[model samples]
Target chain A: MTANARANILSRLRATTTQGSFAVPDAPVIAGLALSLEERIDRLRRMLETMHAEVQVVSSSAWLGALKARLRARGLNGLLYGAETPLGAALEAAWEDDLPPLVPYSESVEQCREQLFHIDAGITTTRGAIAENGALILWPSAAEPRLMSLTPGLHIAVLEAGMIFNTFAEAIDQQAWLQEGMPTNALLISGPSKTADIELTLTFGVHGPKELVVFILT
Target chain B: MTKTADVLAFERNVTKALDDGQLRRNLRSAMTTLSQRRRALFADVEAFEKLRTQGQSIRRRALSRLPELLEQLEARCTANGIQVHWAETTAEANAICLDIIRRHGAQRVIKGKSMVSEEMHLNHFLEEQGIEALETDLGEYIIQLDGETPSHIIVPAIHKNKDQIAHLFHDRIPDAPYTEVVEELNAIARQELREKFRAGEVGVSGVNFAVAETGTLCLVENEGNGRMCTTAPPVHIALMGLEKVVEKLQDVPPLLRLLTGSATGQPITTYFNMITAPRRPGELDGPREVHLVILDNGRSSIYGDPERRATLQCIRCGACLNHCPIYTRLGGHAYGHVYPGPIGSILTPQLEGLDEAGVMASASTFCGACEEVCPVKIPFTEILRMLRNEAYARGESEHDVKGHGYRYTTVEALSWKSWALYNTSPGLARIGSQILGKLGQHLPMIGPLKEWTRTRIPPPFAPKSLHQLAQERGLDDDR
Candidate 1:
């Protein structure tokens, strides 16, 4: 039945007789203008901030201290981190004993579903960022899984300033996404989850993180 | 209006919708806000026009080679370990979904925002088979709780205000309290739907753009429910109309920019997800099995005609709806279809034969607001007018529009034929004008012109025709 359906549908489409090529004169790609790193960061910060996301820049060596202070200030008790990544080890080694507990995502979701949902925040290192739309491109892996940036109330994303790109196409090309084969799940997140479903009134944090705080390591 | 059973229902629904004060207020405010947001975002008119051209080119190029793209998409998806199914009709789509569910022995399914699933009526069908299907999107959840269909495509519950939603949650949700506060209502939905995401055995979602080169399904959503639906469950099923496919990954960015900017004036949605496969060996999360169902459902017939095929280029942005005068006034309910507004005016009839949904074409005033704001620049007024002709042609024309000439009646056809004859012949026209100048004022609402006069006042005729006055004034006449 499915085979016949495919055949019939394709045949009907092939039968269209009118001849006109659907081609447009090529032009420079829109949204592809190059920008300096400083301009990119400024653009990214401005766009995300308008959506209620917090963006802060800190020195590469001192960013963890800033993250700790922000988390402490917010009274977050548990911060979920990738257990297998190098950043996880660094976080573990530099942490003070009195600070919030760092929960390692060592188990499958089935084993830690409750804890995953209840954690104060989940932090992940972003693959790269898009400056044009103020988005973080996340390619989920074994260590920093898909749900680390989702599920929790607060998402703390750490990004290196150099990893930001001017546009989505540039990021895809520079990262060699098509050649490398696309990941199982890739995401471009610009802000905390939101919805305007209720009378077209915007409300934040319907099903994803209520707050998205970014720490750009300069 | 044409004298048909469905036309009467369409008129009645329009009247009923116009009478609803709350619905009118909600639609008016929402349309105003949405259009303003879009306008502000696209303030750079020249740049926006360039991007729109890019978007139009991408969609048209993909559609031109749709069959080949579908084949390539299927092959790449299969290579990535995701199963692909083809369905020619909504019924077949439903059957495929049921088969997948039964194979997994899944009793509970959670669905994200999928208009295609709504087209298939999958929720109601699954319920009859004893499987519980739940909607996880906050707006969809509210309407599902109330046992209602979506009025607007982008915002399903746009017809109801916050107060109405608060009342719905209080009455329907167990142990829920009434609250008009938007945040609290959203929190309630988030808490309720989170539980379903955890317990659901299967997840269902919609595809916004399917990249054929990489076999990737891209979903654009502001809420994370779409992510949860595809990730938290053990199995994920994605549904899309065949027109959603694009030729390459490079085609996505421009289209995405146009869609987001035009939909709600957002530079980008909160989350733009690109899924190429399910969970892999080392992945700690995401669904283990993924399936893609491509539905035809009369799209093949639409694609068979070059002129009508432009209808498939729509990205479902709803920008046209927000800009339409008729849609803003009546809201989405007046049209009474799965899809509504200007896009629906052309789409539903094409999909469901001219006889059944032909009245929708007449709903437009041809003001062209919808065409002006359309991101891809779909010639909406042209298509609407063309559909009206198709309905009246009744299969007499070469085109294969179903139920064509459904509006034709012997009396109406004869009257139009005679009217054409009398006007073309100068001798008969002069006599007709003389009669109208003498007695047109005394003419009553009768025959074909009766419906025309129902909402309109008859014009007072002058004592003489324009030609007679022109000749009396000694204007040059070739004759």
Candidate 2:
């Protein structure tokens, strides 16, 4: 049924034609996507490493200390991310105490969806990995709304060691919900929010999260 | 209406904008904010590149078969009770809009932010025709009130600071107090525009994507102003550039995703209004009459030209503006045209004529960054290069001499023998460089060289060229 739906969508798209008043490129001569899964992952990892270097990382407890240190170091308020329930608690406590704006995670995906609309940060779990591209498949369950992954300035993702797969297709295959006829909305996040908007001036954080952090736990 | 003569006059305007530190600060800050937001949103989306490729392909397909799809769209729109008008030029487009206004007896027009309208200078034309046109978008309204052209494609009043806007509002509204708060100012603008929307007899909007399959016009906006403009007024007129047509409705999702994501870094904008026609009999709210004016305005001429046609793929997300280094420093006013940044550098010359806006071609650093971030993959740098060649062909090569009075006429304008003699011979070129270097040292700050020396010193000639050095070093001796 899913395959049939996808085919229907593709056919509908192919059949539709635009006005002949403008010039469009001929069908894209797609150079084969040459990079292997491992090469893709390495490229992504390198990109992440560069991004991480720009940010000051803190343990779940040392978030406030890290924030203060980052403020002193960069002369700007740094984004905060927490790991688990304790991190959420700390963020909530910080918000109450008027520290820095910390993005909090919810147990319920629907609640996460609501929070996603107005959040400064997004926290989600990576279900699998794509080796060719350093892509993490974040399953958009009820707790992890797709918007949460988009709207925030900072994205803090928790990746359990065992859940990482080699490719997007492999990750999809592992999803029991797909076999059970459940809908899936997945996000693959790699880096911080960035735009080459000015004259190709690389500006960080326009309408989305500027910083992306992934916490890998064994 | 021909901006050919005004291109030279824009230098003085650019000088003024350059001096205004406050305006520069506002532009820099706003662009920075928008850029960062876009980057963050795209970071996690692996399919972003794929989506961009898809968008490019879809737009290309649409453009390749535009005439047929336009007919289909016209048929569908007319069947759906919408009126379609084809305009060959800006004047024709404006006149058509004015005729619609006259037919409706509309005294006032409420407009959403439409770059096409700006390109046509529709507001000024409408005011001259004795009809009041109110910009409903907050940023556009601010610029309209100031009697200024939009500085940025996405954020029209991006050059205006909060305090400046607050002051403008205080001056305009009798009882409104000055406030530095942005949200407060937005609320005030909303209040001011709401009244206009309710009283407005006609609404004018720009189409983001026109679906040929269903004759649907899609509008993506953060504010509900577009919704108000399209629905509240009795007559709604959608001004679409001929290039905005897309083949199918499904192809719209990816393009919309790219537009909103690239523009505001949101996965989707607050409102995505897709209107096929005027409200049907049972509809409670919507325009009674829908008029879609498909404006050619210099687009059809470039349609078959392979080198220039890629300009049509632009989605106008303003991502290039946000990330542009030159735009960050000089601001949009430096280009002295409606569209600015990488897109503007290539587009302005094409639409307005290369000879008319030749100076704008030099505005780029050829950074290739615009191409990198472009959702539609418009090779802005390559297009700018083409425009530069075109500009030179039209005798606008004075700017290309690298310094004042260093005319390329001796070689470029003279015989092909002169060009070949200077370009092909390595020994002669080296000797010339050596002499120039010596002269540069001896001639103490004279002529056009003075301006060149102010920012950078010309390097002395080396005994061996880099190619020679590489060859001596046992590198590939291709040179």
TM-score of every candidate: 0.97, 0.65
Give the alpha carbon lDDT tens digit for every residue of B278-308 in model 2.
7655333456789998877666655545556
Which CAPRI tier for candidate 1? Answer: medium
DockQ of each: 0.70, 0.04
Those runs of model 1 whose alpha carbons end farther than 4 Å from true positions after fitting are A17-31, A73-77, B1-3, B474-479
Per-residue error for B198 in candidate 2, Å, reads 1.4
Off by over 4 Å in 2: A1-218, B1-15, B394-412, B415-419, B423-440, B443-448, B463-479
- Compare the candidates by TM-score and give the number of the best one: 1
Highest DockQ scorer: 1
TM-score of chain B of 2: 0.89
* TM-score of model number 2: 0.65
